[model samples]
Target chain A: MEFNLLAAFFATLTVATYFLTNIVYLRYRKTLLNPVLASTAILAIVLVMANVSYDTYMTGGSWVGTLLGPAVVALAIPLYKQRDLLFTNLIPVISGIVAGVTVGMASGVLFTQLFRFSEQLILTVLPKSLTTPVAMQVASNLGGIPSLAAVFVMVAGFTGYILGPSLLSWLHIDSAIGRGIGLGTSAHGMGTAKAFEYGQQEASMSSVAMTLSAVLGALLGPIAAWLLL
Target chain B: MKYIYTLLHILVIVGFYLMGEQLQDFFNIPLPGSIIGFLLLFTALMLKIYRLEWIESGAHFVLAFLPLYFIPATVGVIEYGKLFSGKGILLIPIVMASTFLAMASAGWVSQYAAKRKERSD
Candidate 1:
């Protein structure tokens, strides 16, 4: 009975919370204030006070996670529609992903190394640039705790969300392709969402960067682990 | 058209679920099945074997709700409420600080590379 009611509350809350966040974003000219992130902060406080287990949260949370399948499938149309543009500008995007993912990972590894962090912790950091679940999995396979990796994944997304545009502005990096691909590639889907705030091209490029970056991160994650270990 | 796209996605997921592990071992990469299959499908299309018609609709649906994936993530923030109030309060600055640092570093590198590419050309 308790579980059922929790699930019910989660279903209601996730949607309500999501809409609420979107409204907040609208009011702020969609500035760095990501409503979803903000609301999560609020909800985390509420849930902790309620003393709910994570498993209980997942009773409802998984619904959102399950949707990832269909969401990934949806990326196909934009890619197909933009097929010509893809091949035309393939070099820059690929170059961007390679450079972005490599630098991000290498820099992270270098930092952890400087601190003389444990191998497991360093491996966890490897997937910081990808999505949470995927990054978690990469960490596990390479002998790190998934939960620790989750830390960096969130950090990575927030990093991208907060600094992506500001850094772009600071560097005078104004090209749509460059901005979209770089953020998407480095930041994943959340970063892509930020890219969309800029324009459709940036959105699509961000998507492309996201997909390619996931693959590149997966491919490179273990290699980095082996060498670092 | 929409139905076909859904089917393509189903096929991609199933195909990967079955053989993705083997392929990952073969390539010596760390990618899981679903992701590897996604890459394979994209590669096939890029090679022009898998037609766009098969993937277009599903891709549209996926892209439409891409933002929703983060819907659950906000809940993640709530998970740390106790820590947030406790010593975990330290995490606020830690997370915020690192995030900004990581973003700046990534954005800067990308921008620098773009400029370098221009100058070299």
Candidate 2:
């Protein structure tokens, strides 16, 4: 009942559920029922029913979010190890990141406007397709709610995970690198997860794209907001 | 040998966070600590300030739970239910669908451009 205990409970619950769900995914190869998605849905449901606010949930959420720094920095080893591949494919990778991030941001703005959403909502929603912390900052700086940006990123990531592969198939693009970047550039981490399942090349490139897209999106999202919105 | 440097992960993360935060402020910007964190680690490895083991353990642990962080946000969407209350459930699907389409198109466009560049090379 106490807020501190309640927040702690949720935090523990978050970590526990995530670990368990991932284990389940490994055993069952996953489905529509990803642990992360399931856990998020579960917490959201509990918090609302209990009348706990976003601030309360964020007490725990922020802790997890803070760890993002270490995890992101860790990406360097994988990326650095892959430098030879990067060197060879540097042109394509850099080009893909630019085009992917630019188009993703532009279209997010364009589509939201088409829907008649206010310009503020447009800025908030435009950054949704990126990773959370970055998405939050992008939204915040552009005068959008960081909370809204967090929500959008989740929706976009899950949407990309659920539908990105099928969409790519529909487009008839088959290479692993293409598929990986396809998911990473458009969908962020969730998309990267799906890409990992595609194969070795898909996973590696997905990681590459995921990292590049996050950095590039962070850099570009605000600029796009200023110039376009 | 290369993997040995991977282990000092937490120190690497802390170092990056502090330095990255400063860099963002110095540049008069709002760089996400995570993005800068990665940049810091990447720079170190690229520059060989610390080897791979220098930060491997912390990095691995943090990445393992990366997906879970999004869970609360997705669930939080339920709060918006009343605001919708069938007023625009249809719009939800439309918005979601359009977002998906645009995201997919963006990815493909990037791929297309990348492939085109590859051919020219």
Candidate 3:
């Protein structure tokens, strides 16, 4: 009987928390605070207040997490829709993602050494530019912690999404595809979400960059570890 | 009828994912099953084996809720909360700076390349 009630609470809580986050975002549209950040904060606080264990929360949270695989597969639709534009700008798009991945990993090495961080921390930060799923996989492959990679990826994403526009304008990078690719390569899904706010073209380009960056990051992650570490 | 279509679409997607998993298990591919599934779907679309109408609704439905799927993992951060104290705090500045650099360089490179292409063309 107690288990059933907890199960019900867990099932309902994920949707409710997500809905509440959406409402907050809708009301505070000008703040540029994303639903993911807002909802995670609210949910974390709630769990702490209720004295719930992370394991208990995962019982329900994992259900929500299961959707990520399917959701990522669903991205094929947009990529299909934008196939023509993607082909037309293939060179720029590919190079941009390559540059981003290379620069992201290089900077990570530079900074980790500069700060004298542990090798484990360096491994975790190395894949921060990739999307969460790919980043996590790469981190694990490189002998780093997957969960820490997720946090690093999220931080990189939030930074890119929140500050990306200003940075783009300041750099005078005006091409929609360029801006979208940059944001997506750096921020992954969250950056793509922010790109959607700009226009359809930008959103599509961001998706392309996000997808390519994931593939490239995964392919190069181990190689980078071999070379750099 | 509409709901049936959506369900069928979802089944097709799941089928692709399973097929990709099978291939990966056999061939020892380095990439994930979902990515392989995504590529398979993209291929089918490109080859005209499946029309957009077949999966459009289901795909859009899943995409709409994509952000929610990430929350669980984000919450997983709590598991490692203790690890973030000493050396972890430095991650904030490092991640922020690298992200900025990645975005700026990517945008700059792509834009320059595009403009150069346009001028040459």
Candidate 4:
């Protein structure tokens, strides 16, 4: 009975907090205020202060996490919608994702090695640029902690969402496809959301790039793990 | 009635996910089942096996709450207190630099390709 009650309470808390932070994000339009980042921080702090264990919190939180698989499957809808544009720009789109995913994985391994992180930590960060669910899966397959992999994915997302625009502008990456692929490949879902601020084309391309990067990242993650670790 | 339709659509999407899982288990594939499900659904749509409207509303509903689904796992990071203390904080800069490099390289390559395509056209 207590488990059920706690489950309901934490589940409600998670949803309510997400909505509230989402409102704050919508109002401020700041990457730092991203709903995922804000809500994760809020919930983490609340749990820590209340002395709640991660296992206890997950009793309810897992219900929400279960939906992630379906949400990833749902990505097919947007990718389907953008099929025409994707094909028309196939050359740049494919090349950009290939380059970006390679560089994203390579750079992650390179930096983590330079910092002399543990092998497990290096594996965790290997799939950082992929979408959250895929990254977590890849991380686990590579013998890293899946939960920590999620955190690294978020860090990558936040980093790209915050710094991506200025970098794009400075680099004269003015084309919509270029901007979208750049952000999406580097940041995943958060980057796609940021890409929306540009225009429909950028948003569509970003979503496509985000999905494709997940596919490519999954295939490449193990290879990197083998080569680096 | 609308809610029923939405639920049914969601069921179909989830069904695809389960199918992907089964296939993965059977084949011992390296890819995640969710990704296999995504590809399966995308192919089904392309092949016109599933109409867009059938899954459109459900997909939208699910996608809207996508970020919410990630909270549980991300919050799990609190368990790794050691990773975030002291020198571990260096990860912030490391992540930032790599992300910048990725964005720059992708943008440059795609922009160059796009510009070249434009010139040829």
Worst-scoring 10-residue span by lDDT in model 3 chain A: A30-39
Candidates ranked by lDDT = 4, 3, 2, 1
DockQ of 4: 0.85
Q: Can you write out model 1's per-residue Cα lDDT over A1-229, one digit (the tens) per residue?
A: 9878878788678767767877787788554557656656656666778887666787887777665543443344455567775676666767777777777777677666665656766676677877665676688788876655665676677677777787778766688877887678667777887898899988888877777777778788878777766
Q: State candidate 3's DockQ.
A: 0.73
Q: Candidate 4's error at B62, in angstroms?
A: 0.5
Estimate every model's Cα lDDT from 0 to 1: 0.66, 0.71, 0.83, 0.90
Candidate 1 achieves a global lDDT of 0.66
Q: For residue A144, give model 4's deviation from the true position in Å.
A: 1.0
A58-151: candidate 3 lDDT, tens digit per residue: 7777777777667667788888998998999999999999999899988987798798888888998999988776787688778887767878
User: Candidate 2 lDDT, tens digit per residue, A1-229?
Assistant: 5877867876787788778777877788765567866676667667778888877777776666566556666677778877776777776677776777777677777776776777777777777667776777777777876765676776677777887878888888677767877777767777878887888787777778777777888888778888886
Number of residue pairs clashing in candidate 2, backbone atoms closer than 3 angstroms, sequence gap of 3 or more or interchain: 13
Candidate 1 has which clashing residue pairs, if any? A44-B78, A71-B62, A73-B58, A73-B59, A74-B59, A74-B62, A74-B63, A76-B59, A159-B99
For residues A105-158, what per-residue lDDT tens digits would candidate 4 score against the true structure?
899989999989988888888888899999999998889889998998898898
Ranking by TM-score: 4, 3, 2, 1
Which parts of model 3 have CA positions greater than 4 angstroms off? Answer: A1-8, A31-33
TM-score per candidate, in order? 0.76, 0.87, 0.93, 0.97
Model 4 lDDT tens row, B22-44: 99899998999999999999999
Off by more than 4 A, model 4: none
